[model samples]
Target: MDATVFEQIRLMLWDVDGVLTNGDIFISAEGESFKQFNVKDGVAVALLAKHGVKTGVLSGKQSPALSKRCEQLGLDIVMTGIHNKIAALSAICKELSITPKQVAYIGDDVIDLEVMRHVALTFAPADAHMLIKNEADVVTQASGGRGVAREAAEHLLMSRGLSMDEVYKPLMDAWNATVVVQ
Candidate 1:
């Protein structure tokens, strides 16, 4: 893949359950009970934000837990409960005043294909569905919910001439800076 391709990415959208949560949704009688998320992904989103890449989730399903997590991430785009991803993505692009050629989408399953094709770049986690991985422009080494976002973000930044140290130092510093006063 050309480094210039990644340089054009202004918006990086993610798919929630599989991409960020290891694809295990715990359902209860009440409904949409819970899902586990990796702290590494949280750090990934924060890193993208600091580097001027808008990050967000576009899930076919929606739940309270998902909403809360997006809020904590401070995502610039959050469009869950989305059935028609292409339409939703179009709206998002219009809202952001960016063309599809300036967007990158990371998805882990079949549901994400439509939107992925419309974006400038497509990424899939190592453990993503075969169909998705086969179609992705980049198949990250890390599995879903296992710091794939970090890997993807690192790739994007490195394309822009940033070293690994330069990419990770702020992530480390930000975590260290959140100390609580005793």
Candidate 2:
């Protein structure tokens, strides 16, 4: 919860399965997997973008649903089917011209521990593995697939003395303009 950590966070990396989707995987008879993402979490991603924080995804497994969701969020730095998180993170850091300390990571499993340790800030959903929660700098009250990302986004803004109203004003204005035209 250090304000300095929040201040340093230029990129926010997320773990998809447990951190964003409640760790659930559903497969159809045809062998396609689907994951449900929280709508509020999508808004959180937009809010971060509005506030000048970039977002990315790192997942151990690959899924079309995850890829589509990242596309919708306009996230350009996504890494899926990753085994060596540290190496992936290192590459990301190099590409972005940032250090590990300039990033924040939210994760739920043991696979996330090493990268979580390196980031400026670490967050875990309330229902994350106990070990992950223990390692997190911030353990969100909201569980995964709920409003955890929203909570984290709010925290990010608050740490910088920014308000949600301020962060979302331009987006809301654009939305209002579109609605009024209809």
Candidate 3:
């Protein structure tokens, strides 16, 4: 993968179950199910958005937990419970006024193939399905539910001649702006 590939990305989308998590569903003894997410991914999402890169998630499964996390990160697009990922991707591109060539995707399973084919770049986690890894533009060293998103963001920022501290500067400024001067 080259910097040119990452340089074209104006919007980056994700697959939740495997890309954002480890693809394991935790079911409690009382029948409650939960998902655990990496905090590093959350930071990447926020900082990327702050750095002017749009972010989204497209998942086949609907999850309140995912929804809450997206709210906290303020992602630009979130389409869950989707069966036709290509259609969703097309619609989202149209809505965002960006072409597929301006989008980069990260996914980890067979279900993500359709959308993956249409994007400018595709990233796969280290532990992704064989097919996904085989087809990905880049196979990250970090596995899913780890720092995959951070790696992706770092690559993109590097392409743009930027740094993590640069991405986070806006946030630090915002924090300092709101602090009381006591």
Q: What is the C-alpha local distance difference test score of each model? A: 0.85, 0.84, 0.83
Residues 153-176, model 1: lDDT tens digits: 888888888899888777667766
lDDT of 3 at 149: 84
TM-score of candidate 2 relative to the true fold: 0.91
Cα lDDT of model 2 overall? Answer: 0.84
The TM-score between candidate 1 and the true structure equals 0.92
Best by the TM-score measure: 1
Report the alpha-carbon TM-score of model 3 versus the true structure: 0.87
Considering lDDT, which of the candidate structures 2 and 3 is the better prediction for this target?
2
Q: Give residue 59's error in model 3 in angstroms.
A: 0.3
Worst 10 residues of 2 by lDDT: 173-182
lDDT by residue (27-140, candidate 3, tens digit) is: 677542677788888777766766678998999988667778778767889999899999999999999898999999999999988888999999999999999999898899
Residues 1-182 of candidate 2: C-alpha lDDT, one tens digit per residue: 66787887899889988888888888888654788888878777777776678888988988788888888777758999999999999999999999999998999989899999888898999999999999998999989988788788888878887776776785576664432110
